[model samples]
Target chain A: MELDPKRYAGKRLLRREIPLSTTALREALQHQYFKQIPTLRKEKNILYCNRCNATQPHLQNINCQNCGSTHLYCRNCIQMGRVSYCEFFYEWAGPNPDWHIHNNPCAWEGELTKHQQIAADAIDQTMKQNGKLLVHAVCGAGKTEMLFQGIATSLQQGKRICLATPRADVVRELLPRFQQAFPTVTVQALYGGSPDKTGDGQLILATTHQLLRFYHAFDVLIIDEIDAFPFHADPMLHVASEKAKKQTCASIFLTATPRQKEKRQIAAKTLPHVFVPVRFHGQPLPVPASKLCFGLHKQLRKGTLPKGLLRWLHNRRNPTRQVLVFLPTVVLADRLQEEAIEVLLPFTQKILPKRETETLIRTVHAADKDREAKVQAFRNRETAIILTTTILERGVTFPSVDVAILDAAHDVFDEAALVQIAGRAGRSPADPTGEVVFFHEGRSDAMDKAVRAIQVMNRRAKRL
Target chain B: MNLCVGCGEAYTSRPSWSTFFWPERISLLCKDCEGSFHRLKDSGCPSCMKQIGSSICSDCLKWEKTSYQGVLEKNVSLYSYEPFMQDYIARWKYRGDYVLGKVFEVEFQKLYYQHFQDTKYEVVPIPLSAERMAERGFNQAGELAAFTRAKRKDVLGRKHGEKQSKRSRLHRLTAENPFQLLSEPPQYAVLIDDIYTTGTTLRHAAQVLQENGTDFVAAFTLIRG
Candidate 1:
């Protein structure tokens, strides 16, 4: 079988992932369309994987059963495919892909706000100059809409674009919206088990991990939720994003919470950035109010709810509003669900049926199989309260919901997480003043910093 | 700092009171990844360790009717072939992530010492054909055998054929034995493999060893499907 020249034009892939025989691949190499790169390169005594850019520490040697010799394989990217000493990674050395330029690609009818327009213009200018720009907008600030103008402008220049995010859920959510916004453009979403493994799309929306398969393929790259987990925690992903972009490509980072390093860069004027303090609905972010709950852990261990928490739940300002309780860990969230049921059973039985009361409370975490269905149930108002870990702290919007963070002193609730959790409330314009409370045994510095940051944003929004 | 082989998360080991008196056991997997592997209970079949009743399973009884019957004594496995173990085996064996075999080092050693401390049996790992070995790049059974500090013998050879995983259970049972004894058999032999699916492969190996003058033969596997 003959290999497609367009399919392997700009891809760096494993031999097994490509549906062609070794003879056909050799034929392509002989024709100067593809080149073979050593999977593992030796430097002195250390080894490096050319595919994943993994260093010496991430490589391990084992007795090879294939050649009956000792060989090294990269452990960092073994999940994708094993890159051993004897293997080679195939890279395209042929002509670049000819991207189709659309005259008027964007089909969106909505308009950006005043602040959003300023950020959008800056993004367009940055892309034209092949520079970097940071979009530091608050949650629900319509960040996606601001990218339409910049994306359309780049698409008109016949540039291949990719929008990468840290979380698969964010990529899943943004793919459809971008496809609708630019109906003429070929938009493909790439994740772990996504069907679109071919990199033929004009605009690709992918998780950061999927960028490892590309080799200088994108002319314009936009990374959303840049501070989310796995991406920020794993250095390999940073290398992947850098390797996926062309030498002179424009890079745009969109995030609601900038880590300390990015904050320093912005402060030093080393990185150009635009900040949008007000949400798209023209409402200030909800500032979390800290409440001292003495012996909170003891009460939970005793299978009883804290007095202050119980009183707050019973006397909610808006009884019809849904509630989200964030715990520090999955075990704590699950335990709280069990204990809250026994403690609140008497009160809930008087107001509702037993089955309805049971359905009113649920717990979800990162590992929960029914997390999507449960979150959907919460959005449908079938469940009144959702107890979860930090997985639901961002990228999910629930309108008219009050947020509470239990054990706010735990180390898991960092300043960025707290800000993102508090930002989840009051997302809709109809109920722009949802309550956010931090229930803790004692105030943590992260809690204080988060509250202060929200207040500063609110004050800045007032001036705007 | 130690990184989990399963999830690739960095974790710092905490020293406990037990660690002060005994040698510290290093953890290669995190708590969550480690917890996902379900250990086999003692209530399984006495011969093959399949989670059927406490008696000898029907698979083993059917094997008794064949020419290789009574050649294999018993088979003990560490984990049940649950979904987590299935995926783990795929990565470790098929994907050629050889370092993942180390994740079971400590537990595999502990189980080996607990079961075979009193007896002196030569550990002989089942061999892979030359073609399959050249393809996979590592013998999973050989790596598992290294976890045990006992004397290991590589005196078995296998012919190139279709993989057992691709064949149905009945087809596997009706197929000819692929094992070939390459040297003199030990007085007592313990065969090591990664998994015991239908016990046909192990029985063929045991039959070869038993016919070559081995007195007793038993199998030790990582998972029982």
Candidate 2:
């Protein structure tokens, strides 16, 4: 007897949520209507999360220090339910869904560029064939728009699609865009504390952590920011992501910075990928120039920026322009904020207008309150310059903003981070060539690699 | 590999004279974790066995002044709720790690036999609410009672509400009767819980059994918080 998979389709019910007991299931088994339907597949020793499909051993053991139970709970996917040694989680393995049909779902009227159209067609073809592909596009290359065709194709075929990213912020940002593109398809953002936890949605925009609660739920899984933090580093989340998709589901990896391993796989012809080197506006990436500046940390500690850096800041001051000063660490950013106010304010007051002096500098890091408001202020040109840590390195766009890396030679400033930070400038069509300066004690290989990567992309874009 | 229940680390045992004397006894915890748990000595309150300088602890004195005074005669706890024991107990109770109950099997069995071997009392593990039992999978007290020789019964049950550990001390004292008598209890009953936190839960449980015609009740907890 095969269970109807349509009965469990888009239904993510925890055992606690099921208002029935083993006796009720037994009764169902004895009943005339449900007697022929296959019941749950029982698994022991390893409790599987029916909501996220995360199995035992992959689940982290969380000891409750308050109650003194050694193996009292599961923390791996605890938000769904505490899957313990005593409990069992079940899955429905009966039949596949029959309704793979829908109307024209995409409502977006925007046209893709020639380069974007070619890549978009390839994506749709690959998705239809259930193939794995890496969409290796540069930052600001209309990567999100290229995904629209593939998403629309999947929706028209009535297949479940999930667009997962590494961070919650990206999920939130992509939710409305996806909803606007596929207005007919049900789109819901799935993250921690999401309101639509139990609702069935055809399209799911979720953080990678949220995928732990989904077991073989999607027919198509698109992982945006494939090389981002937590998703790139954590293997448990990778397992969860894989577990969330159907066995024959197509996977699409979207990233600006491809890892060495991914690149090698692509080179070896084992992984299929499409590269879009040019920006949507048909412009090359802004290249960063490095300048040698020794003892900047000592100067920051001594309450003064170097004369050359101060002069550069003074020269770049305009009401229409915003500057981003990237620091290596939060502590360094905080210390520099105090020193900048003391040393740079008097210098700014002597040169700039009074209203502009009020919005000279603001500092933001991971711990800062009103983070969104501060970032909005910078975007609106209310702040002339904002000093920050690596939190604002990626997924942030500000028009006509110049970037300065405080210590580009620092070990924390890897090539990927440098490339992302450099990408912050020259994003908008109106300001397609903004200044990116790397003030370093000594030029590191990471800095050189970043410059070389940008030059290679520009060369490729020009040839295309 | 046999792992330590306290720290979840694999530890090997060396042959020693203690092992020879007690051949049946096995090393349940790693050496470092074994050293961290501090067992209570006989130099404290006779009522709850807390390490006060008097026979009656201040907590027991405070309990006596309450409305449900003298219901719980005495409570003999095994270990002090030190940081290590706190973590050990938490893992067993809240985390649903039922296998960690093996660490306390031998010593708790010894205590159960030594204290109530001659007494005609039934061991009643504090019953979990339907919601909590489904969530935690097993009751910590019920699992711990497997070590004792007394006949266990589902004599008392609790109405689901806010957990006692989540409530303040004042609120816990003023909390309403959450326990219900499921079946006829024996003349003497022995209450079992994982920890003796503020003693309000134990006092309430003891009061319910006493109100239902049980002559006397004592408590045995794994740790005294």
Highest-scoring model, lDDT: 1
For model 2, state the Cα shift of residue A101 in Å: 4.1
Listed in order, the DockQ scores are 0.67, 0.07
Docking quality (DockQ) of candidate 1: 0.67
Clashing pairs in 1: A65-B137
Cα lDDT computed for each candidate against the true fold: 0.85, 0.76
| Candidate 1 CAPRI category | medium
Task: Give interface RMSD, every candidate, in order.
Answer: 1.3, 8.4
Model 1 regions lying over 4 Å from their true place: A1-6, A42-45, A302-304, A341-360, B1-71, B78-91, B103-124, B127-135, B146-189, B197-216, B223-225
lDDT of 1 by residue, A168-198 (tens): 7677778789889999999999998787878
> What 10-residue stretch in candidate 1 chain B is worst by lDDT?
B18-27
Over the true interface, candidate 1 deviates by an RMSD, in Å, of 1.3
Model 2 agreement with the true structure over A1-464: per-residue lDDT tens digits: 33345545534444564445767655544542121211122386545444344454434443333345544234445545565533344444334566446678888899999989988998999899999999988888888899888888887788998888887666766788888887777788987667766535778888888777666788899998888887897776887788788889999999898989899999999999999999888888889988777787676656456665776776764424567888888878776777776666654443334655656778888768767678777877676678888878887777788888888888888888899899888888887877788998878999999999999999999987
Per-candidate RMSD vs. true structure?
4.5, 7.8
Top candidate (DockQ):
1
